[model samples]
Structure formats: structure tokens, C-alpha cells
Target: MIEFSNISKSYGSVQAVEHINLKVEKGELFGLIGPDGAGKTTLIRMLTTLLLADEGNVLFSGKDVVKDYLYVRNNVGYMPGTFSLYQDLSVEENLNFFATAFGTTVKANYHLIEPIYVQLEPFKKRRAGALSGGMKQKLALCCALIHKPEILVLDEPTTGVDAVSRKEFWEMLQGLKAEGLTIFVSTPYMDEATMCDRIALIQDGHILDTDTPTGIVAKFNYTLLALTGKYKQETIELLRSMEQVKNAFPFGDSIHITLRNGYSVKEIEGLLQKNSVAYEKLEPAKPVIEDCFMDLMTSH
Candidate 1:
């Protein structure tokens, strides 16, 4: 278990994170979802004892992170956002180095990494720098798990990887969670938020909201509709001009309109037709995590 109380961090007068308080249950997959400058990395560093929080306390399994930094470090595996592995070493050699540092060997904890290592064994002789993005990711994850730590802290592990590799990485994490490992990960992709048991949306050093995917979507207090057709931007501009439209923005190839009170499907459709907008389709659309996050960021 990991717990933090009123934890905050800053660089000079700039606040990186502020008053963050949360707990991660054993064997649960938790996520921190946000964009690049949302302070996810700062909070992760503090939790792993790499960066000290100027206020509050962080505890892991009843052990304070500051007071028991070394002991806590031994019980956790941390993978920063940047690729920090030995570039000159072979995939096999890199694993050996980390295992030795933890006073263990790959053979000792081979079972923990069997599923991931199976794919990497073919590239065992390849230098860390020679591996592809997906291969590098797998190698990094394998090295982090070499010690069989109780919890894994990964920061943006799939940032530059291909779509297929990103999907595979999340699948591997699900396997780890089933083996009773607490997984705490951060990602900028809002679509990935639904994969976790619970998620906290952060922006500008503050947590906007924390809840399950469905719970977050339930908080969106508006009737959402997807509009896709010719003159998409014009349709958005038209919707934006109406006082009844609560929100209007482009979502992929479609425009998402949030209708206000008294503006139902009929009124919106009539207005669009009056403006000579050729909409191929317009229908009620359910809100997702992205929609909820945007609302929180704007209203709060």
C-alpha cells in the first residue's frame, strides 16, 4: 500500500505539485492521467523518494518515504519518463546489472519476468541502444522487475512507442496486477484512463477529480451530441454563436455540441438547417473521460 498526505513540491517560486493526498490499495492498477506539464512526473518522483516534497508526508506500507527512503526504495521499482538504461550494454547484460544491484539475479526472479522476457530473449544479444522502441520498452520494464519489487512506478512508459506496442504493454501490466503487484502508472492519453481501476486527473499542480471512468463521465452535466458532415468548422462556429449551446468544439472529424437548457435535438437541428449547414449525421453522444476532463479543467 502507498499513502501520501498533503504532499506538495515546488522549484523556487514555481509550484510543480500541491497538496496531493491519495492511497493506492494492494494489487490495484492506479493511473495518473494528464498532459505533459500536468505535474504527473513530479508527483511520481516524490513517491519513489527521488525528489523530496516540501510539505506533508509519503508512506509506503506504514513506512514513511523520507525516514525510510532506502528501505522504501528496496521495496519499489521505479521507471522514470526518460529512458535511463545503459545504452552500451546488451539486453541481457543490462538485466544482470540491475539484478546485481538488488542483490539478486535474473535466474532468481526469472518467473516474475518470464512472460516479458520470452519476447526479449531473441534480442538478448542486441545492445540496449540497438533495440526498437517497443523492444526498449520491454527491456526497460524487464529491468525494473528484475528484483520482484512489491510495487511498480512507471512514468509515461509508452510515450513514443507504436500503437501495437502500447497495447501490448498495457496487457503485460494487467498480468502483473493479477500477480498481486500494485501498479501505479501515468499517461497523457485520456483514452487509456478507462484501463485503470481508478484514475486522478491533474493539471497545473492540482487534482481536478479522481474516480472510475464511468464515475467521471457521470459528472458531465450536459446533453452531448456528435455532428459530422461538410462544413464542420462552420457548424461549430454556428453552434458557438447560439446562446443555448453550452459548449462547441471539434472532436476528431466531428463537432461535439453540449446543449444548454431549452435547446434539445429539435432546436439544434433547426438552427443548423437554417444556417445551411450540410450535416450528414447528428446524434446523441455519450461523454467520455476526455469530455469530463475538459469540463473539469474549464469549470474549476
Candidate 2:
């Protein structure tokens, strides 16, 4: 339902987004994965009609976003990274306010936000500032969905929330996707990238890669080995110094190491033994989305 063609946006001399061409299929949950300052917010703003692109064009349902901004705004629900709700406004009041601004009423669309609103009902009379981080997030989501817009555009919806809240929020999004809502969400968390139908890995104001999370992981063209020993730090240093190692990074208790071209698992085991690294566990592991992302970034 959304299409961006070579879209480029700049702030004076600084280019926040460069030549971004992307498409979000109808009823698909698409994710943008990147770190901070990766142009995710800028791209989302352009798509939501909050910012104009300097080059190329953005189309929402075939309508130019710059030219048909009001129409696009009416059809899309946007929740920025920050909590933009009024601090003094009660939960119900904020919901009503947003709905009214869109020429709708909370009562008219209660069913649409019932799942999210149920969590906020107890705090309906409480001011938004009084709610916890998770509760505030739910309240903001309720306000965003109160109007029942056709498309949902959320920018880093789970940035600073707790782990449990983050999990709950994603589950809620999955529920929305089942209802056929087109979702375009951005997040810096690589783990969340796997939750989307498809994800675009963005970096340095450019798209590194875009594909299904599983597909991207499958494309990782290296045999990954994880090593854990008493001296983890020393092991990482040793692996990095090895001529047969291409990329070595510490992942939790194990060090994920990539072998250089023309190297075999037997060769790696021999090398580790020759170095006297005293490793206790060594095993081959599959590449995850983050691993693929790191490989892509380093290659670029």
C-alpha cells in the first residue's frame, strides 16, 4: 500500500536519507532495522507526510504523499518514537482527542482498540504522565488505533520499554496484522526484525539489504563457529589474530568466529589446539539476522 521510489531527503547539507526505494505490500507487516541516525525516522516521516523528500516521490495507494498529504494522513496512523501525547490529559481524554481530530469518536471505533484499551481502561482517569512506561506505550497505541486508519506507521514502538512490555507490544502487533492492517514499523532491535513478514536492513542512510529474516540469514555465506572457554576474552583475541579467521565477535558466553576462505572445520580445530586456547566448548551454529546484518555492514 506504500511505495517509495529513489526517495532522498536532506537537511541543508546533511542527507538523512539517500535514494531509498521501498514498497510495503497490502496487509503486510514490514520492518526497517537499523541503528540510531540510520534515516529510519526520516523515511517514516516522509511516508507519513510529516516531512517532504528532496528527491524522488512517495506514493500511498498511488497518491503522491507530498501532493495528497491530507488524504494520506487520514488513511494512515502514525506513532512517533517519543511519547507525543499530552502529559496532563487522561488516557480516555487523549484517545478521544486524537479520534476527534480525525473526525471520529472513541465510541465509534472502540472495537478496533479493545485489546489495547483493555490494558489502559484502569488508568482511563489517570493522566498520561502518571502511567508507567509500558502503560504509556499502550495508551499511545490506543490513541493511534482509535481512528481505525487503514495503515499503521510506527517508528520504534519498543525502544525503551522493558523486555516483557516489548514482547507484549509485538504480540499486539501480530494480532493487528491478523486483522489485515498494513504495518510499517521501524526498530533498532535486530531481534525484532525476525518478527516481521519482511525486513530491510538500513545503515548509513542507505538500505544494506531487504528480505525475509529467514532468507537473509540463509544468505549468510559462511560457516559460523561458536567457542566458549574459561578465558573468553583471551579466546576472542586469539581468534582475531588468527590468519584463518575473517570475522570474530563475542556473542554472550561464546565467541562467534567466521573462517577465512579455503578454511575447513578440521583446520580450525587444529589451529585452536595448536594455539593452546584451552576451549571447553566448540560447535557450529546457524547465522542469525544480527550476524547477517553485521556481515553486510562490514562488507559495505
Candidate 3:
């Protein structure tokens, strides 16, 4: 439903995005996964017709985003990263306002947003700013879906919400996807990437890898060791100093170490013992999206 061909964007000397070629098929839930300043917002803005690219074309449903911007705007539902609703407006008022602005009525498209709006029904008269973070999130989503657009573009929708709310938000998205809504969502959370049908791992304004969650993990071609014990900081420093160690960084309570070819796990253990760097567990670790992302980032 969306395609970015050789897309590049810049602000002065800094390139926010570069040579980004991506495709989000119709009815597919595509994720743009990256950390802050990785250009996810810039890319989304360009796709949503809110910003123009420095080079290349952005097409939405086969229409040029530059020339056919009006159509794109009407056909795409956008929920920006921040809470952009009017603070003084009541929850129902916000939804009605958006629906009216789009030349539609709340009742006309109620079915499209019913699942999400139902959760906010009890607070229909509550002022938007007075609502909790999770409640505000639901209100924004309802407003976005008020028009029943062809695609939904969410930019870091779960950034500041609580864990339970984040989980609920993804569940809502899955329900939307099941209803055949083409969804293009960006997030800084690696765990959220797994929920998408496919994802593009981006960093430093460049795409590192784009694949299904499992596909991306399968491409991690290295021996990963998870080491957990005392002197965690010392163990990381020691691992980085070794010529055979390609990358070593903290992962949760353990330190994930990737080694170069010809480096054995036993050799690492022996070296740690030789240096008296005590460790309780040091074993091969399974690769995850974050691990793959870090590897791609450091390798570049």
C-alpha cells in the first residue's frame, strides 16, 4: 500500500533518512523499528505527505504522495508520536470533531473505531488532558480511525504508555490488521517489532535489515554467548579487549558476547578463568531482534 523508492531526506548537513527503499503491501502490518533519531519519524512524515523528501518518490496506493497529496491525506489515518488532541476537548468531542473535519459523522464510521472507542465510552465526557496516558492513547486512536482510511500510520504510539497499556495497544492493532487495514507503525521497542508481520531495523538514518522477526534472527550469523556472574563490567571490558571478540554488550542481566571466526567458547572461558574474572554461567545464547540490531549497527 506504500512504497518509498530511493527516498532521501535531510535537514541542513544532517541526513535524517537516506536511500530508503521500502514496501508495505496491502493489508500488511509493517513496522519501522529503530531507536530515537534513527529517522523513523522523518520517513513516516514523508509517507504521510506531511513532509517532502529531498530525493525520490513516495507512493501511497499507487498515487504519488507529492502530486496526489490531497488523496493521500484523505486516505491515510495518522496518529503522531505525541498526544496531539485538544487538551480541553472531551473525549467524545475530540472524536466527533475529527469525524466532522473529515466530512464524516461519528455514527457513520462507528463500526471502524468501535473496538477502541468502546474502551473510552465511560470517559466520553472527560477532558482529554485529564485522562490517563492509556486513556489518551485510546482517544487519539479513535480519532485517527474516525475516517476509516485505507491505511493507519502510527508513529511511536506506545512510547510512553505503561506495559499493560502497550500490550493492549498491540492487541488492538492486531484486531485492526485482521479487519484488513494496512498498518504502517514505527516504534523504538524491539519487543514490539515481533508483533508486526514484517519489520525494518533502522539506525543512524539507514536501514540495517528488513525481514520477519524470525527471518532477521536467523540471519544473525555468529556465536553468541550469554555470560552472567559477578564483575559484569569487568567481564565486558575483558571481552572487548580480546581480538577474537567481535562485539560485547550488556543484554538484560547478562552480557552478550559475539566472537569472530576461530574463537571458541571454551577459549573464552579459559581466558576468563586465567584472569580470575568469576562467572557463574557462560553458555551459548539465542539471538534476538535487539542482538541482531546491535550486530548490524556495530558492523556498519
Model 3 misses residue 267 by how many Å? 1.2
Q: Candidate 1 overall Cα lDDT vs. reference?
A: 0.89
Model 3 lDDT per residue over 122-166, tens place = 999999999999999999999999999999999999999999999
Worst 10 residues of 2 by lDDT: 227-236
lDDT (tens digit, per residue) of candidate 2 on 1-300? 999899998899988989998998999999999999999999999999989899999999789999999899898889999998999999888998999999999999999999988888888999999998889889888888888888999999999899999999999999999999999999999999889999999998899998999999988888888887765577788788888888888777778888767887788788888987787778888888888887888789
Predicted candidate 1 versus true structure: per-residue lDDT over 95-195, tens digit per residue: 99999999999999999999999999998998999999999999999999999998899999999999899999999999999999999999998888988
- Looking at model 3, residue 172 earns an lDDT score of 97
Candidates by TM-score, descending order: 3, 1, 2
Instruction: Point to the candidate with the largest TM-score.
Output: 3
lDDT of each: 0.89, 0.90, 0.93
**Candidate 3 lDDT (Cα, whole model)?**
0.93
Relative to the true structure, candidate 1 reaches a TM of 0.94
Local error of candidate 3 at 222, Å? 1.2
The residue pairs found clashing in candidate 3 are none
Cα lDDT for residue 50, candidate 1: 90
